[model samples]
Target: MKENGIYGLIAEFEEPDQVLAAARQARAAGYRRVEAYTPYLVEDLAEELGMHNTGVPLICLLCGITGGLGGYGMEYFAAAIHYPINVGGRPLHSWPAFIPITFELTVLFAALGTVIGMLILNGLPRPHHPVFETPFFEQRNQSHFYLCIEAKDPLFDRTITQEFLLKQKPAHVWEVLA
Candidate 1:
């Protein structure tokens, strides 16, 4: 546990199903700070770990609306308010002329917002994590799966958690240090 220098304990399994089972068990055991790592996607594993909803979609929607309004507003100000120019006898506040720029800005802002929001939401730019120190790739096949119970979990106790993980019958149980 985080009581000392321990980040948590990580259990390595040979198959995806094994890690998935361990994740479910850990969740049921009241470990809230659980995390899983696998060679590929295991969709059900995320549900078991309570990693469902994210705010990236809301961020995209808000940013898209802002970009569209901003683009249209800028065009209106430039063409009608700042310097009115009636080309071809068209009205100064021609909204049709603003559509292309508004559409482009909406898409651009949404895409950029999605990326930035995902990074911020996921705590990205993490050059290093405690799990990275573990020998996950070393001592076994390349397709191993790992389930970690972080010390931040309220139910974490070094001795008891170690015993619990042993009961899961993992291929290997490692004490991950922070």
Candidate 2:
């Protein structure tokens, strides 16, 4: 059993289907802290890995709404209340004039929120990950599929997890070092 902080077991498979199957089995066996890496997106993989309920979309929506409201409010305050500028005999609170800015701000905030939300959700900007300690992890971006069960899982133990991974018939099962 590895005694490192990142003491986790990784199972390497030749095909994405095998990884998906192993993930389903892991989820069924009550493993909550499991993640799979694949070269390309796999349909139903998120559900199999129990990662379906992400909140990024909701966050993006809220941010877009906030941005649209903020832009509209700023325009209202500047043109109508604070510094009323009636140009070309137009009304101070012209809705048509504010539409373009409001739309632009909504798109800008939605895009920004999506990017930041994804980064935050995925725990990004982590230049170095404990999984990098494994030699075979580099194959993740190529042909192999990997499923890692983190030590943070309540049912995690290096020896038992390694045994379980081996039973899944992976080509290689290694312990990640922190």
Cα lDDT of model 2 by residue, 40-74, tens digit:
89889989988777888998999999999999999
What is the TM-score (0 to 1) of candidate 2? 0.92
The list of candidate 2 runs beyond 4 A from truth reads: 1-6
Q: Local error of candidate 2 at 53, Å? A: 1.7
Please report, as a residue range, the 10-residue window in candidate 2 with the lowest summed lDDT.
1-10
Model 1: per-residue Cα lDDT over 41-149, one tens digit each: 8878988898777788999999999899999999999999999977999999989878999999999999999999999988998988898877754545357888889
The residue pairs in collision within model 1 are: none
TM-scores of all predicted structures:
0.91, 0.92
The local lDDT score (0 to 100) that residue 60 gets in candidate 2 is: 93
Error of 1 at 154 (Å): 1.3
Residue pairs in candidate 2 whose N, alpha carbon or C atoms collide under 3 angstroms: none
* Among all candidates shown, the one with the greatest TM-score: 2
Scored against the true structure, residue 67 in model 1 reaches a CA lDDT of 90
Name the TM-score of candidate 1: 0.91
